[model samples]
Target: MTIAEVSKKYGLSADTLRYYERVGLIPEVKRNKSGIRDYTEEDCRWIEFIKCMRSAGLPIETLIEYVRLVQQGDETIDARKELLIEQRKQLIEKMEDMKKTIERLDYKIEIYDQAVVKKENGLKRTYD
Candidate 1:
């Protein structure tokens, strides 16, 4: 497929795809004899994976480092694994905090429900 087809298929801007290529976020794309980017399914697959990681809150710099490590062959395997593990730990911590926040919000809503009910019953109250 062409770049436009790739962009539409992935729902990414043409410029973003170019930027990814330029920034080393993606591997060097093979071009045809006519100097057009002839994208293959494999290229598209990597684009989709990069898109997923980006959507998952992975930083571009981290992604760049990861791509670099990947291109370095097998020597950086341990570092890549450690990076993923660390990020997973952080994500878990963030999710736990979000869960606590949601619980607090639900608790507050319960209190607000009581206040509204009491107000409807003509039992006025003041809060400091």
Candidate 2:
């Protein structure tokens, strides 16, 4: 598929796709004779992986390193696994922190709700 098609399909801007190639986040895409990018299935797979990692808050440098390791053939398998494990640990920590924050907010909201209910009840008693 052309770059435009890939961009539309992946919900990424054309410029972002080009930037990913330039930054080595993805392997160089093949171009047709007319100089248009022709993305392959493998390229789409890389895009999906990169998008997922980015959404998970993985650092760009870490992703670049992972891509480099992938290009280095089979010798980097253990290294890649270690990298992924470390990233997963960090993501889990972040999730835990976010969970705590959500719980705190919920508690605050519940307190306000109870206060409102109490005030309404007091007002009704005063009126009656």
TM-score of each: 0.85, 0.93
lDDT of 1 by residue, 4-79 (tens): 9999999999999999999988998999999999888888878997999898788899889988999999999999
- Model 2 gets an lDDT of 0.93
Off by over 4 Å in 1: 125-128
lDDT of 2 at 73: 94
Worst 10 residues of 2 by lDDT: 119-128
lDDT of 1 at 49: 78
Tell me the tens digit of each residue's lDDT in model 2 across 1-128. 99999999999999999999999899899999999999999999999999999999999899999999999999999999999999999999999999999999998888777777878888432211
**Clashes in candidate 1: how many?**
0
The residue pairs in collision within model 1 are none
73 Cα displacement, candidate 2 (Å): 0.5
